[model samples]
Target: MRRLPIRPFAVLATVGTLVLTGCGTETGDPGDRPSSAGADRTIRAHKVMQLTQTHEETGMTLLEGPVFDEDGRLLVVDVTAPEGKPKVMRVNVSDKTFRAVRTQGQAAYTSAQFSPYDGRLYLTDFAHGEIVSLAPDGSDPRTFFSGEIDGARMNPDDLAFDRKGNLYVSDSRGLREGEARGRVVRIGRDGRTVTVLAKNLAAPNGISFDEDYQGLWFSELTENRVSYLRLDGEGRVTSSHTAIRVDGGIAQTDSIAVDANGNLYQGLHGRPAMAVFNRNGERLATVELRGRTEGLESATNVAITPGGTKAYMTVSGPGGGFLYTFDALAKGIRQSNGG
Candidate 1:
């Protein structure tokens, strides 16, 4: 049940395809993008699954942080080269038409996620510092959370939603770049707030819930580790433990995601590609990746393609940001399906 991005208005009603982009790109194709000493075509790419040239930024980059709605439309909040309150745009996956999503938020948006349950969009304003929801028909905006919790600091950078409609936000807790104290707040319908479901954690960048709601998984950026906490009846932490620790020793792990089969995909902050971990916390795969060198170099956001097809990631750009798609199998990709 995917809805078109067009309202029943008199004009501008068009259809588009869903796309995923990332990487601070180099001015060449994947084959020309990067190569190791003996690396050649053996590092083949699967159909170049998808490509984005941010012409807006001199054809050297694609905006980072791409997400999708049900209609298969790709939405990304470009932090660089922002113009007049319009920072987010929808890129037609099948085609290459760009439409604006939000032009003004009074703050720079770090990341966002679409609510499939309601077709509403939620975004984090890292600069002005808040979480907001965009109107369904692309209308007004509303505030969900701000850096103020009971008059305390709660600046949010990332967001995640659970199966039952509970909202999870990754509150960096402070403004310092890599602060260790962070919290994941679950906002219940009753407006009640809950924490870490455990506490004294590291910089939890991305937060996700297991399909069964039995537990929650989150990753620490500076710590380069992912942890899982069994949730109690009220979504509080019952038992928490590390699911995967960056083996390369002290690499920064940014964004994280889980797939249909229950495997984890984690983006290493300083690595050339992303890493895969089994639900059992075993090392799985390292997704090969590279960009135009003109855009983003880091993959900070990750999503599982709808229908279990591809893996979507967002790499912030040199100026605009881009989204890149990967062939999970062809790339020797392993999903977080507990395998």
Candidate 2:
């Protein structure tokens, strides 16, 4: 049964409708001020499908790491199920129909990305501290890398790849807040060598390249900040700094996606919303979700489609988790070279 909210909230901004801008405060909270992009045409995100529900025994129906598959289905990771089993499910966006992927072993898959270069799927296995690759049809799983760097454990949480086939991974090291054990590393195209790009991070969660591939952006959960790194030809961080910081409204900044015009869409773990920012780190808009999807507690991650017209977000709330689709005015940067 489709569990609907007690009361439904009206759409704040309809799709393709232009709005007027309002003055905003320094904190960037929606209540204090309106976003510049808010005046522009916006789309009120509607719930597309309920992907997972909370399990009675474990209460862990958390969903994360959503990616569009080759056949246009949405692939997501469900962390908790009956008997403490973790697995991945493929969902048909058009009909909201889904089924678990057939796989072996303890399912601790956290994230999945389709490699445009080699036509395979890359996934992060948090349980074994390894990265695995699989066939397009979810078969022939094999370990890509499962080792440490500088004697620290490689507790990878999220990954992003560049056009040259290099993969960047954020190692959380399972550290708590304020503990700076998190780091970001890169796997060479050869897939054998692991190089540390930066260290002493605070719960680094999402890793993504900018529109032109000249800069990299990542989110720090504990610090509530997003940092940008400029890279030279050799894939080395030439300079870096904090681009944006959340003060009061949103709690934990999770995954991030970049649009074609360099606007960033960030997911919040403590707040049921997605925050948008310009290239200079200015808050452009906040798409808040509540009473839109059943049991939605927080927005965990976001992904913008190729042309940037549509967006997909993963939410983990009270009863279970859901995947949502909406019309996005900002066009997302199309990943190049088969990302």
**Tens digit per residue, CA lDDT, model 1, 1-339:** 121111000011012211221221111122331122222221111222333434332223323355666666667765432345346777675664577777653454656676645557777665455667786445778876654654556556566666555667666554254446667777763335645464455656666666556787787665667888788777777788887777644346666666765656666554335665667776555565543333235556555556654555665433334456664422211122111
Candidate 2 lands at a TM-score of 0.82
Name the 10 consecutive residues with the lowest summed lDDT in model 2: 18-27
* Clashing residue pairs found in predicted model 2: 19-39, 24-33, 116-338, 297-317, 308-332
Candidate 1 C-alpha error for residue 6, in Å: 35
Report residue 248 deviation for candidate 1 (angstroms).
4.4
lDDT of 1 at 217: 79
User: What does candidate 2's lDDT look like per residue over 1-339, in tens digits?
Assistant: 333221100011223221110001111212322346434222345567777765554434556667776555667776444333446777777777888774456545556777657867888765557888888777888788877788965767678888777888877664433478788888885778788888898877767788888978888776778998898877888999998896525356766777787777766665567777777877766665524443565665666666646677776655567776654546645431111
Q: Estimate TM-scores for all models.
A: 0.74, 0.82
Worst 10 residues of 1 by lDDT: 5-14
